[model samples]
Target chain A: MSRIAITGIGIITPLGDTLTLNRQALQEGRSGLSSLEIFPTKYASLLPFGEIKITDKELKTRLDVTEPGVTRTTLLALHAFKQAVENCGLSASEIQLSETAFINGTTVGGMCLSDALYQDANFRETGSEYLNSYDLSSVTLYIQQRYGITGICNTFNTACSSSANAIMYGARLIQNGFVKRAIVGGADSLAKFTINGFNSLGILSSAPCRPFDNARSGLNLGEGAAFLVLEKEDNVIDKPVYAYVSGWANSNDAFHPSSLSDDGEGPYLAMQQALQVARISPKEISFINTHGTATENNDEKESIAMQRVFGNVPAFASTKSNIGHTLGAAGAVEAVFCLLNLIHDEVYASLNFDTPIEATGLVPVTEYKHMRVEHVMSNSFGFGGNCSSLIFSKGQKAQ
Target chain B: MFYIHQSSCISHQPTFTGVDLQNLQPSVNNQLPAIEPKYINIPLGQLRRMGRALRMGVGTGITLLEKHKADGILIATSNGGIEDSITFLNQIVDYNEGRLTPTHFVQSTFNAIAGLLGMITHNTGYNATHVHRGLAFENVALDVTMLLRENPGHIYLIGGVDEISVRNYRMEAMAGWYKKEPISNTELYASETEGALPGEGAAMFLVSNNAESATAKLADLKLLHTADENLVANQFAEFVRDREIDLLLSGESGDSRFKRYYTRCEQAVSENTAIARYKHFTGEFQTASALALWFSCWLLQNQTLPEHCIKRSGSKTAFNRIALYNNYQGVQHSFMLVESV
Candidate 1:
């Protein structure tokens, strides 16, 4: 079997725009959560969010996009992808004129644009032309046109687990000799739709969300994009490698449409499958990047799954406390953080920790600490019991 | 070889349980509404949490599992729960971006159906959802076949579902993608139209390693993301000829803009071999080809083709090899070959 290597990474997160800046913010325990102010929503002043502080015009200019009025989701994807393509050190011709596949995962592609158009009273006369491009497929078409990637381009929308599945499929394609390389990940932007949706579930936390904490309330919505350039191991020997996607698996709970199973059976199976594929044991796992959405059900169920698999809990934290939940982009963004952990060899603390949850007795690493991290497992669970786990190793050469 | 064990479809047609191929009653021109059976009666509390798309997806998925009992599930949709998403977005817009409900938001995600199916069946196994325009179902089916080849014991449940909303219709109309003229779906191929009438449905299948009572043993599947007509035609011929296909299921929506691709396929195959079409019954969407697979499974298991599907001046033979060719507009071209065990 061929090995899969991560040769390049690009990120446009609330923590910062560049990967370096995001890593610095994580190390410094700087929280990107603040009162939402970009869009004119009543929830903007009330809900705490992890919003990227940039205007639409600036984002368009930086990403070299001609259509400034396009969805913010597209702009975010372009911003992250540009950095990823550059980081791979591949010439523009290689990316724009090659057979490289772009497999993206996104939950809300152009919902913001649709909302903006639908709200205008003169939408029927003035904004009708733009309504056709508001679906998920159009977003992928836009990106494909911009990059000139005539290869297989598709979008995965399995909620938060969307991007993890994207990465896993990209690796499978490389292993199966389908495509030589792939630009895979996901992107989503803050919209009133998500904010009120989480609020309706009665899970929104007015204060900072505390993951694995007994006093945890709910998750804060955030927006961003993360992309990785993956190639067959032999194709990226001399390139500056970020980390290897050692193993990954996706499983369904089949329990409920929106809620997770009580035993966390699906997540447990997915984690176990990923380990089997990586040919590693639970004891060998150095750290874990948990999908702690700060929701009572998610935190509790995920911790139980962790306990069942690992007996002794590994040091883990939820970056959602700092960057908010980026929905489809969560998996890729968290994977990026895992690679950063390997580079720094330090465990960044989970922000807003107060007390451990009573049911699981799980306490996340609340303070940054220097540690010799080797392998890290990141998990992302979405609405449809779509549970995915990805294992990122320290380096290509292995420890 | 990965073999299809059982397949089912719950569309406007009354073809759910039996293996016999029945001609569907055209519902396109009728003013009388055609409604599906109450999803709640299919099971308990299954429809409570699901929106229309989720209900259709899980309903078909459960029916397949009850027959074949799969170990994992894979689902594909071009636009999942867009109605719910539109409703949620409208609420946000109407309320001046104020407090909005979460049910629609939670339901709007594409994988929600696969996740729900996993939880209901207690089959905590590999799960995934693909949403690639017209090839969504083909990509997911290919993934299932690949997984079955890699891991021998698992019984995989793969499904493709898409829903039609008022907003979806209006949006497609604005883009000049759907036809404005009314025509019976059954007569979709009879005319020289340039565009297809949009429709929605769900199809699910139980695929297993064991070839017991298998409809067909899946031979090979391929998807190419290109628009070059000559390249697509050449690839289709090579793929089918290599697999020794004796029959072909062409995705002809009767749209002249895209019908040429299928016509090219007809010209390539031998005249003695049978040719069939299915999108006229299922409508066009990302995963509509799953319907083509469902029809293929029916023919392979029963050893006969329905009269409604006859497209060419050729007689149906005791064919044991079949190939499915499908595409959306000019992009996302896919080919699959199946043979009797």
Candidate 2:
């Protein structure tokens, strides 16, 4: 099997919009959780979210989007997509090649404009502009059309583990010789649909989420987009490499629709299988970017999973404490953060973690420190008992 | 190559419980309802909470899994649980508060089918959901092909499910995706219609690398997107040029706008190749091509094509090889070949 390298990275999170800014914020242990301001909702004052502090119009202006029915989700996706393709400096011809593929992960898609869609369903004499944007693939289709990509395009929706699966699937395509290169990642925008959904589940926190903290009540919902350009080692030898996608595994808990099993069987199997695929022992994993959603079920279950996998957990942290849980984008966003960890040789703090859980007695890395990181494992567990883990190993530097 | 160990479909046709589809009638209503499966010992509480999409998907999924066990599960959905999602969104607007029901929200996700199937089957292996508009089923097929290549000899249960709702149907109707005039299903192809009749259903396949117990062999498949008829013709020629095709199953959804693409396909194949259509029976959705695959397997297994689906009969009586070609609104095109074991 050929090695897959992460040649380009792009992100638009609450911490910062650019890669440099996000890395700097991570180094400084800064939190982006704040009260929702741009969008109005009943929980605006009560809940904190990692909202990307930019207005839709401003984002449109920045991305030069003039389309009529573009959703906020599409804008965020376009922003990150542009940065990723440009980061790799891929030419237009390269992007339009049939050998290339674009695999995007998203939960919201155009459904964020639910109110408009509802009206279009009720009173519209003609078709509403939002009609074409309601499905989950609309964002990806929009990007494909904008870039004139003729290759195979797909959209995945496995909840929080969606993007991680996208990355995994992309690598499989290359490894299997289905495609030469694939641009894979996910994006999600804040909307009333998710807010109401998470609120109904009673998992939305009123303050910044406290991952792995004993007093942690629930998770804070957030929104962002992240994409990584993945290419075969041979295809990207001339370009700069950020990290190598060494291993990935996806497993289901077969337990619950919205919560994980008590023993963390899903997370355990995912991490164990990922390590097995990487051909590395548990102790070889340097750090872990955990899927610490700060929920009553997720944190403790993830802690138990870590213990089951490594016996002694590595220096792991949940960037969710900094950027809240980004839903479908959590995987790719955290993957980028893990790459940052490998690139900078530093471990970012899992903010708001004051105490460890009683059952597992596991505490995350709470302070930023320079560590000789080699292999970092990133976990993304989603609703429907979907759990996925990706192992990104540090690539050899150009001496 | 992938081998189909077991297959199940819950569609408008009488496909459940291994029933014969000879008595199927031409549908008149724009919306064709799928036949609900009879659940035996499964949990009723969980089934009751599921929407039509989840029920159809899990119903067919469990059916296939019970017959042929699988280690991995992959599902494809186009719109996916639109009824539940629209209902949930409506509730949010109606109440406009944080206090709302969680069931609809829980089931509104696109992966609801895959997740529910995982929970029900207790298969903790690879699980994924693909939601690429018209290429949903094609993408799932591609993923399964790659997966079987990597882990040769592993069994995988892959499926495609899409549910239709009034809210979503209305949006599509407003967008003019459906025909304005309701024509008889039998007359769909002859009516010179501009849009297709909306439909939804679920189909599951138990695939494996082992061919010892295979019912039919999946030869190969291709997916493309273009508006050029000549390019489609060339691709179709390349796909069928090497194989001695006995029957050609074309996705002629009765929409004249995309009729040229199918016409190009018809021109690409040999004159003796039998032609058939299924959109009139299964209606049209993103993954309706799955229904085509199921139809192709049925033809190869039974060695005959139902008269209703036959557009042009050929002299070949022995159905050894069947090819499926699907075109979605002239944007997404896919080709799959299935042959008898």
- Expressed as tens digits, the lDDT of each residue in A267-291 for candidate 1 is 8988988999898999888999999
Which stretch of 10 consecutive residues in model 1 chain A shows the poorest summed lDDT? A120-129
Candidate 2, lDDT over the whole model: 0.88
Off by over 4 Å in 1: A67-69, A91-99, A117-127, A396-399, B17-24, B27-35, B48-50, B97-101, B190-193
Work out how many backbone clashes candidate 2 has.
Answer: 0
Report the error of model 1 at residue B331, Å: 2.0
lDDT of each: 0.79, 0.88
Writing each residue's lDDT as its tens digit, candidate 2 over B124-224 gives 98899999988988899999998898789899999898987888889888777888896777788886868888888898999987889788888888888
Worst 10 residues of 1 chain B by lDDT: B27-36
True contacts kept of each: 0.74, 0.79
lDDT for A293 (candidate 2): 92
Calculate DockQ per candidate and list them: 0.54, 0.80
